[model samples]
Target: MGRKTEQTMRTYHRYLGFFLAGIMAMYAISGIVLIFRNTDYLKKDVQVEKKLEPQLTVANLGKAIHKKNLKVEKEEGGLIYFETGTYNTITGEAQYLEKRLPLILDKMTKIHKANSDHPLFFLNIFFGLSLLFFVVSAFWMFRPNTPIFKKGLYFTLGGVLLTLILLFV
Candidate 1:
């Protein structure tokens, strides 16, 4: 590539690296948190004690948990639990583990999980393609014969090999 092209690639790589730094951090943290999904360590425990109205039906449990109108078909023991909503009844409290990501990170994560109905689906696709372009452009940022480029090539090969092994092995 010409000097100007190389410089332009380097400039793009540097700025994109900076723009993605915070997002990278969020993904790292959320990824780690997601790895321990089977545990409650990352979740905050909420305790609630309230006197439910007498003559309550098993069907009315969802309302007792502040999620009224929830379809609850049965009541077990002193508690009524909704099949798909919040639960708060009896001495035993319902555990709600929630994590609120920062606005930008949250939006990015939502875009990643976007469906066709999501308004930012097109933008998400564009950003993803731009990232792929950046990855391909990285090679031209350095001279083909440079040691760093050679080392990077070797590392890239090793990473691919490892991924393939993990996928099939």
Candidate 2:
């Protein structure tokens, strides 16, 4: 690469690293938290009360409250008892205990899981491109003939190999 290109890459890489440090940390922390999603790690149950449409059936109640596997255990005097809590058919009140992470952690996880349909998808794409830029810019940090550059290549190969092994084995 030309000296000018190398210099530009190095400058941009350093600045971008600084700019993206907070987001990168968020991704790292959220990724680690997501690995424990199946477990109840860092989750707390809190009682939640919501006002839904009145006189909803058991099937409609589940859809209204955004609970998928909601089963009505029993009914007594227009009130229905489910797994987490109870709902009154006569009134538009639904009381439930939901287990969730703290607000900030939950938001981080949501951002981590953002899909094409989500507003955060644009941020995800930008972050992905920034990471790709970092990977490419790294090559321009040092000349290919240098010992440090050669060692970096070896480390890169090791990372690729480790990723493949984890993926397939």
Winning model by lDDT: 2
Write candidate 2's Cα lDDT for 1-169 as tens digits. Answer: 8889999999999999999999999999999999999888999998999998889988899998778878989999989999999998888799999889999999999999999999769999999999999999999999889999999999999999999999999
Misplaced by over 4 Å in model 2 are 55-59
Candidate that scores best on TM-score: 2
Report the poorest 10 consecutive residues by lDDT, candidate 2.
Answer: 63-72
Could you give candidate 1's per-residue lDDT for residues 1-169 as a string of tens digits? Answer: 8889998888888898788776566556666655665565445544444455555554564445554456654566755555543344555455332334455545545555677798767865766676787878889878988999999999889988999999999
Tell me each candidate's TM-score: 0.59, 0.87
For each candidate, what is the lDDT? Answer: 0.64, 0.94
lDDT of 2 at 54: 84
